[model samples]
Target: MKGLLVFFFIFILIGPIVADVPVREEQFIYSIMAFNGRDYSRTFCGENSDTIYLIADQDNFITTSKTLVYYWPITGDWKTDTRSLNYSFEGTLELTEKRRESRIIYPERYTFYNVKGEYEQNWKVAMGDEADKAWQHYQGLIDEYWQATYQYEQAKMAFDLMVDELAMKITEMRNDGIDVTGLVEKLKRLGPPESPKPPDDYIVPPMPVQSAFILNLPRGEYNICFINEDSAVMESSEKRVVVFEKRRADGIGFEVIPGDKWTRPVESKRSSSVLYVNGTTDLYLRPFFQDEYNDLYYQRMIRNDAKGNPSLMNWVYIQQVPGGRIEVTKNNHTSAILVEEPFYVEQTKGSALGYKIVPFDPEGAHKDRDPSLIAFKIPITRETSLIKFELLDNSGLNMAGSSRQVRVIIKSRWQPILLVLCLLPLLVMTVVRMIRSRKYSL
Candidate 1:
């Protein structure tokens, strides 16, 4: 009985030894230079057999109906392509009631390249898997639209035109006696517009959303949020705020005076904590002062710190993983480190696609660094909060991209529970043994 109790205690103690990958820390990169709709980017890599990566989570993606126009350089005209094909997906978000925002995950990834516009006939099939699959799947679905009888004759005419175009191509191929298999192989050799080639490199840009959060953080206790929505529950808040002193290059020290410059912290009736709203909050927000710092200071600082290590301009958030290992990365950057307490490495995403991102507390958080960049992270605690973010170009004008609110939930310390469970069984076993010994002795 004692041994069984010991075994049970051991099992409970060691069962959680393995740690899980931080899903909240997970991020995606995007491009901003030339992007579609709203100018705010979303949608990572278009689903392709070559570049599409299957991840454990696709919840961030949303399928919306829309038309996508990609300019075919060969045609020298923008093609308005419609289908069930164009689906947009937002990364994740955490919106503060104060209306101030930063992004956790960038909703879009993009690429920009000069197209020479030269391709074989079969090039259309090689553009991307999603493009192809969507084409075929949608063709069948839309075929019904073309085949409609009676009152839907107008829509049918449009469908008939599409069929006629396809038939013309098929007839041309047949008249030429083009060996379908051999011709496909020849086209494969020639490849498509988006094929992997040198000189004209196709780039996938970094996606960083700009977002802000008004967490109901209380003093004396740290809160960790896996942010989704509804900040009333302490465990449901995803936004995290880190208090830091901003130091200017001139060595001037200033503190963020909360008021009209910023929103007054509202007290939470549920937890009696303070919360900030997204738009209404009278929070500290000073515009970028050009005379205060050099325009190149931010990237220069990163480059200096990186020391010729290929660091790029980006907003970075740091989080302490289990075992006190810290990982710092921009939502727009991609590199993984697992070895040291605080590890640093350099990585690259798409081209130099510019974005407009505005800092919430420009005076508080934006002084020391480049006014164009902002960074924050959620601290670990037994609570949750919602976080929303968006990314824009340096102008801070247009929304380059945005993330949906990510719910961050902090977990309680398991040490106490582990101790109690460990000891309770031992105590029970001891009592049982004592009672059994008395009976045996009798």
Candidate 2:
């Protein structure tokens, strides 16, 4: 009788497997945002904004091989500019039947845990089978993500470069009494560069130099040529060749003149710095560049007041903070101090939260350093603004161990989970009936 009972149990389990038809379903999401130049039209200079037409496409998608069955655009107002329009393009687009595949697995899984805090997913397939499928799916997803990201990033960089070039060209042209706006449009129409120059290339007409500026060169026996409009060359004077190395002010970008002097630097153990000022000219700052080694320095340009001009006794201020000491120095000259310890800051809306791992090891690499050093800024909203950071290990696994601190603070206004809750009883009844039907052989 015991053997018969075991046989019945095995048969019941196998029956469900035999009757099961592998139903499969899949969903994919692809998104991108690309914006180019805008175009506008105007009839008269009445400041009529109505005549302006802004033309730029954003958040567009295209499936080359498949015909879209259904798709709807989610149109909305621009978040940054209320006058501008925005299109989210977030709806799912179903492809035609011709694009449907013969076999598709349901892209879903259930999570379980043997330990109270451990999270694991159990798929319909065995361990190896699920892993292989997941690997393939994720690999494709990653490739798609990276390709889109690279293209968008390159386009953005190119646009920025073009803008900077245009700005520089406009400034130069305007200084020469030329119509800079007209030149700007002409450059835009010229578009990309061509080898050997186009047959009808629009060349910039040469303009005479109205103002000449000279740089203070080192004392040297030198041969210099200045080519003017008449191709006339003017050459040299015998200046003493004094070679005194200024060290190129190692890693400095710009120098401050007396006028742009900042306040004195403050000597402090904490993170703070101070500088004093005694000048009245424009302060120029530039980005510092170093060799292959990533050495960094801050450079300031100061313009000094001419003789008899009012002295800037307290115009400039500068400060520096290092670990625990706070040092203040005056007159636009100071040394940069390295930060020896991580700074602790409180979390606030729109402020980046800071953390540092304890028991410091200074020589460790970035990855080997304490996980606490990773910081995340809080995302702000008109509603609740909160920032959350998840600390993951080298294996992309969360380290919080289901702690209360990891909980999501904001409760979403729209609760789709409520629908699942409502249908729970129905799902339970159907599952119980299916089990009973197989067990009773009815």
Best by lDDT: 1
lDDT of 2 by residue, 1-442 (tens): 9999999999999897885432221111111111111111111101111111111121111111111111112321111211222222221122112233322111122111111112111111112344355445545555666776677677767866887888888998789988877868866775433222112211221111111111122322222222323444222111111111121221211122221122321221111111222222222221121111101100001100012222221111111111121121111243222122331222334555432223234465433444322112211232322212222333544332111111113556768889888999999999999999999995
Q: Write the per-residue lDDT of candidate 1 for residues 1-442, one digit (tens) a residue.
A: 9999999999898889965422221121111121111121233221110111111111122222224444345544333344423433332433232344433432222212222232211111112244345345445544554554322555556556655655566568979987466544444454222322222211222122222121222211122223333423222223232111112211111112223222222211111222333322212211111112222322222221112222332222111111211122223343232221111112234685332223334356444443321222222122324433322223443222222222334445876988899799899999999999999995
lDDT of each prediction vs. the true structure? 0.30, 0.28
- Please give each candidate's TM-score: 0.16, 0.17
TM-score of 2: 0.17
Candidate 2 stretches with Cα past 4 Å from truth are: 1-126, 178-442
